[model samples]
Target: MKDSFYKYFNCNNKEELYLKLKQNSIDTHKLGKYLKFNQEKENKKIVIRGQNKLFDYLKNNIPDRDEVQIIMFNSNMEVLSDNKFPINTQFKDILDKSYVETANHVILLSHENEYNKLLRLEMDFKLFGYKIIDRIELDKNLELDSKNGIGNCQFTEEDIINGKNKNFKEEKKKINSKELHEFMDYYAKNELLGLNIKDDRKKIKEILKIANQEKSQEYFGLITYNKDQNITNIETSLFKGGIREAKIDPIIITPFLLHQDTDGLIIFHNHPSGSISPSQGDIQVTETIEKMAMRFYKNVEDHFIIGKNKTFSFREEFLLSNYSYERSSNKELSISEKEINLKEPVKNKIKSKEITKEKSTRNRLRSRGQER
Candidate 1:
């Protein structure tokens, strides 16, 4: 029968066998799965030299006898079959025939020395329209060492022994918080010039500390926001020591805003003297950004001043209301406004906290009417 099988295919190598199977319309990978299912239902045993947890699991789970045929391979190229072939049968000698011609499933039990050879053999078996149920690795003593398979068929010795099937949904919920912290720490150290904190307020405070550590000078930061209100990107502009003022040019940042397709922006600069007050220059720059953003149908959401230990939000202080239609005008705005506008009560509360401190720095930046 084996001789007849060999003559039918007339193949010289594994690749030729694969092509032959393909031409014959045999879905080898699928056939492998089907054979595995049949083997499980029948509880067929294709034992190696020694027993282990994986063997025990298989013995307990599979049925006593079934129509499915299982083939086991060892380092010596020994073949355990219903019809006895020679004891030292070379794999190449059997390659001329298709595994599917003789068996329903192929279960390779490989020792450490035989693993690579068995892997190649398994690949050939798969190509020749054979369903491979298990490709298990055994130690030198032939005990259960590792279980390997592709896709859903993959399992571990522990999983089989404990009868534990994988739960993909629950597995996904396991967040690697350590990875997140590491990434943030690296970004704060290497990417930014200022301090890094997880909390927004603490982050601003740390930035203030770093900016004023040795000498006090203004540092400007631009935060770009997407339509979803998430801070998508951040950039900084540094000034010389003892320079209390910095200018922000919309033209310089226009390309970036357009590239990011930013829907809103927050422009912040630190006060080296720890003054939590927006200067006239700061207000003027905010208005300028607001005007330019309106032209592109974008928003100047907030302008923040990071001071000694405190931070001031131009939006929270109602200084930005005039540039936002949803805040200043009573009429209904678009869905985009719904995303950018703060609630009326929140605006009122912010307006109640009157601006108590201010600084004088002049720049002729005017505001255009807020676009709906």
Candidate 2:
């Protein structure tokens, strides 16, 4: 490494090294052709020893394929100009600070399908485009794995009596502005959710769309269920938190699970930033709740991450296989609904009353070769 340029010249920082190279003739000193600065795997210095690493690898070394390149600058890692990117589903949690709090490596994300050409124009028409989705870092003195929603988050009079180091914090898990307005709305007249916002993809998506007015913070939600997977409750205020994190501690919801109507749970939270992609924190909390759910001979049904326009379903995207789908504790066939004359009545497959247009008009339109 004596062949290094900085070693030959008695220079310190990159500025000095640059000035020296321009002033002196490199051919006169006869430096090595294969030139590179001093770089070691675990060097303690933030930059460099002989000189500073003004030439960071990621900033300088990305491939020069303009077709697939995206340039971004950041003052702090908290916010970015970009909100979403197509990345591997497995590494979704990597975006959450709890997973890899302050990573010092480049995060390279790619497309799941090569022919995912639906957004060809929106993605700058680069079918093979690449995006670096880095971690969301906290402000201040760079707290390691910072701004988390775990461990004794809320303060109480009990903490004061016990002389705990906790301070008074806002109780996040409560019905707030959204629900208050809803309660004051037509629901006061028992107009219970006039639309079907209670099951499947539509349920999570529509509910979030209505409740996602607060884009500045996150709201951890829970959909409680009985042993048979029948939902008992769905509340948004399970725990509200600032952007980038929210508490999903199983202890907070343990009482809910103990209830006779609630043996299972489905946990979720909103990405106030409008990205439906599940972060590492989301997965970790889901796993944490699932582990505790197993104790009650149950499992979390799904985790629905609410975005601005979409909802990311853990059960749908990752698949139901990773979870305990089959419950051996299910009741015997002797207790079937048919045996007790409690069988549900089958109605017309299509309920025309719910349809806004009259069936006669729709049929007439269809008869007239309506394209729609």
Candidate 3:
């Protein structure tokens, strides 16, 4: 049976036995459990036998850290320590008084003949709520093996020494307006938006594309900037269309901007059916947002209304001059004639009213002729 078993497993020697056990998904922790069960069944101790390759592997990988606590158990199942406990001390006594609770990792080193003792100690530590992170068994010549008793306790040499893999590198990609334009064009076709801009110009271009999409409704795109005008975060929202109105509260975004230490913000919204002109509501909302931002020491960089392949900039067309003129002289708010005429909705409404009045006059004349 033994010959058949060894032949079937292709394990010729103790080294091969250890390798087969490791390769068969029987890790050190599971092996420890199996050994404990056998010991209890036979009412006798079972020792772990292995080669020194496992120990050498562990020594090469395990980082030397002050936070790691090493405990050595002798063949007699006694704890041996020069710093904390004396030689031939009882394992339970030393363990009960040890400072293993404060350690990040606990390494157990013992002889191959002491496997049963080591397994019992591991079980005890687990029952006592202490994690035995690493365990190694030594051969007859007191040499360490390459196999670790606990499977998940191993760490890579690079991870331990340098905190991360030395060969891993992250590519830093640059954002440009051309890339943004392409991305916007693609997403607009899908009736969706992707807010992943890391550049200011990229963010502005994306918002413009979203606003100018042919079948799109009103969408609000907010771009937050740092003190150096670098884009920090971008967000967007969809709103009901046809009414040509959307409501946004500056307070909803103020907390996040404050947390990010934002220095400025740029807002853009679409007017699906009208010209790229700022109405009275647009001006009022911009002023309200500006006031709120000022209270938090933030700046409103620009508010843009995108319409039918064109865009209106409030700062360039109105706010900058309005603020300067207001500071110079206190006066009622006034809008330029060009701005009013540029508003397509206002012109359409006026034309509709004139047509209605002309129809009413013609109908009254026809009614008088019929009565005569």
Candidate 4:
């Protein structure tokens, strides 16, 4: 089964990128537990796998960096990914984010010489146990000068043909801005938000038909609407996939949400097989983006799967449910600080943790360069 989590972020060679991530570290430290894969596969290093915090960070920073910049592993430890950030991206901007999956086996690419920034960066990644590969150290590993290593990763004809980067461009017909705008305005002016599911389902299906009409490959679409639900702002066909799979990504969709007026979304994709039924993979990504929307306090109105003759809606099917993440906040406590009673923001930094029936054990940890 295809998964957007495992989709390519770029065309970099996995083996070369992994060597850059693994063999090139001047110093190395480890963290977290070994776990079972969601399912087994041959050892491979994906360029980058998407995550909630990565999506959250990309919402604000991808423009400045042009792409993600951390090489880390998903919790399963099966896939190692390299994401390089810009020199100016500050550590404070992404400190202790809401992680849907744990990030470890990491190498943070940085070249900063600022003392406080370096110290803070070290302590922060140290807590998470991520490796920091600086300019000199990275240049030494790549067998090239600094910043030139990215181009060194080799690619083959097959890699480029099937790669995500190429597919995003070559999969769809190139329509000029005017042509795209006219197509968008037709639906926007028709009040797409007010359609009645009982009577207007056919009209909705007609729209999907036009959106993916005559395309032999699958592609993903994200439609953004104004806060009042009256106007359609942007309808972006983000990624094109093979005959069956398309990358349903959050970061690519985040820029639209950055517009203050855009509030609601409907994520749709066409199955070239002419079956509108949602696959397990489809269900997985719908839940993924839905949870992401909740983080922005936005709603994913529906997930639609379009086929030659039918359309399926996740909302109408009751396949998705409410997801709530308690926001970390500073507020006055009901009781004053007396004995065990805590006051505003009782912050706790967990040093170590374990779980067992008998008693929880704490692992020995190095605290600030000394073993404790």
Candidate 5:
């Protein structure tokens, strides 16, 4: 029997297949969770090397001892589920129930001949965004059969012992904090700042009011690193109107990347006004983060203000010792403090009508609004 057809559709034995997955993890620089396969095609099917629920599920559902068909899905490429279905039924019905509707790709694992037929059959399903095997590479280890069908074999301990020499250590170079920070800076300025913090309708309405006024509350993030500092990371729990309260602080914006070992970090946020000033709120937030960093034994090296222009950092004005210039560089205008002229305060007018009420009422509102 031609096992190559099966190996082609699926991977080697469980351990070997897992090793291949590990290799893919190193090659693609992705988490193992992203690796997955479609077991319905040959020379391209995902082989579940170990016996687990997924393997059992495949075996139980596909009683065709000689030729078994399977399908699987994953977050990064890891098999989340290895579901099997009857070949007699249409594949679409199986997919609709087995995989998430948002799946970007579909895998097919079967014998070489069957895969060719599937390629032809899959054209009709393409309209539904069902991306069939984007690739079809041969598996030399699994020999092809001129007739019969593909062989779906199980692994024994001997297979792993045999393939030991093929294994190699993963070469991962350590990145310095500066490089990590630079990477974060680029990603945040280009992609991250655009993300709207998840907010409810009431919160969104409040932000919209500020946004409409051209002075929308801005967001700021700080990434600090120091050789001696123990606090290597700090983040604000939530943005204004983002549902953080005295009992529950807002969830800090998740960093796109974290390199705790290198003691490096990068942070950024949106400028609703398109300006870059460190507002009173911004300063308070920074101070809070700085304090948190100190508690964690990490340094608060720089606070970044991301907007239409480039990202601004607190380190730029460290020499100036001028909070006003730092705030201006961030495109944030101070509303509470008097202007440079000192004759009048900057137009830091409270935009919210509720905030404009009596001092007692405003105090109550402010108290309720402050992040815990």
Candidate 6:
């Protein structure tokens, strides 16, 4: 009653077949190894198709490290797509072209000279992607005369961390008289000692004093306390040039009256050139002052050799004074003091460093280690 014949269907499964053809002609079964589409449609030319949106999903969600592949199946479970074009081929371009996929970030590797140009470009691209730029290293490969050149590379992360840029204006705020005195003290202690001052110690001192006096007309003073704060003591050193009516830097010749309890001292003078050196006459005047200071109970501590950064200070070294003073013999002085029953002198205590909790915390958290 029936002839042996192959059957072909236009639909892939019973659901599609029933919906499209109004009939389910074959039993549905899950083949273990392959999806075998058994049909007698060799002459009828039936076709099966998958959703194109499946490719869009794969392109958008592929993992960073994995590759994607396309699969094809025939009626008898044969692979129909050509294997030559691997599914992973040009997958990167596909993802790159997709608006849904994006890179995590980008890095800039150009030199300082190119930084501005690159920065502009980077800003433009930042709307669509992420990026990081390197800071210029100023110590090397920096060109002179360029504001944005690598010359600025000397700045450190500490400079940024400390908010140097933000605090610049405040750091240079107007200074007070008390601060000026303390700064002078520190400067004298550190910059006016030893061999550096031995030759011109007296002269340097006189000059500094002139620079500090209220009557000084030409000299403007700048001194720093501790390390961060600055103080200025304004004075006129002299009238500029040979104009007789123009007052000249009157050489400061103040007597040393500081007590033994004084911590430090610095004296400076102004040269019309702003030079901080002693003239031959200045030297003689300084020597005379030194002799007078020793006569009293005072110390001629430090002399600054000022000239911008060309400045020098003898306090960094030790120097023996050349002058000899005639005084009462030590035995005679001792005998005179021994004869009197003297009441004990009250001791004055001075706390030089004020250690605040903020300072302690800052010290503890500083990137550097404590000094040995």
- Candidate 4 error regions (>4 Å): 1-202, 323-372
- Minimum summed lDDT over a 10-residue window in model 6 is located at 343-352
TM-score of each: 0.34, 0.36, 0.34, 0.35, 0.24, 0.24
Candidate 6 lDDT, 1-372, residue by residue in tens:
221111123334333423432232332121100111111111232222322332222222221112222222344323232111222345244324322222333222222334454455346435555332222112223211222232222233342233212221122123233333333333333332232333654444433442232122233232211111111222222223231112323233331123323212234444444444344333443345445455553334444444421344433322213332222231212212322222111000101122354477788777465553
User: In model 5, which regions exceed 4 Å deviation?
Assistant: 1-93, 97-107, 111-227, 230-287, 291-298, 301-372
Candidate 2 residue-wise lDDT, 56-136, digit = tens: 322222221111112232323321211122332222332342122232223221222322322332243132233333322
Query: Residue by residue across 139-257, what tens digits does model 4's lDDT show?
Result: 22222122223223222334222321322222123423333323333433243555543456555555555445345678787777555553355353577899979876678777765
lDDT of 1 by residue, 207-272 (tens): 333333222466676766565555566665533234577766567867755764566666777777
Number of backbone collisions per candidate, in order?
Answer: 5, 2, 6, 4, 44, 30
Please report, as a residue range, the 10-residue window in candidate 4 with the lowest summed lDDT.
30-39
Q: Residues 13-80, candidate 3, lDDT per residue (tens digit)?
A: 33554455545543333333432332233223222223243233344333223222244333432333
> Worst ten-residue run, lDDT, model 2?
33-42
Report the candidate with higher TM-score, 1 versus 5.
1
Model 1: ten consecutive residues of lowest lDDT: 357-366
Task: By lDDT, rank the candidates, best first.
Answer: 3, 1, 4, 2, 5, 6
Candidate 6 steric clashes: 30
For candidate 2, list the clashing residue pairs, or say none: 93-279, 93-280
The lDDT for every candidate, in the order shown, is: 0.48, 0.42, 0.49, 0.46, 0.36, 0.31
Model 5: per-residue lDDT, tens digit, 164-250? 212111111222323322322332233222222222222222222221122134433433333333223434313433211112132
Candidate 3 pairs with clashing backbones: 53-146, 54-145, 54-146, 54-147, 55-145, 55-146
Error of 4 at 283 (Å): 1.2
The true-versus-predicted C-alpha distance at residue 229 of model 3, in Å, is 0.4
Error of 5 at 292 (Å): 7.0
Which segments of candidate 2 are over 4 A away from where they belong?
Answer: 1-201, 319-321, 325-372
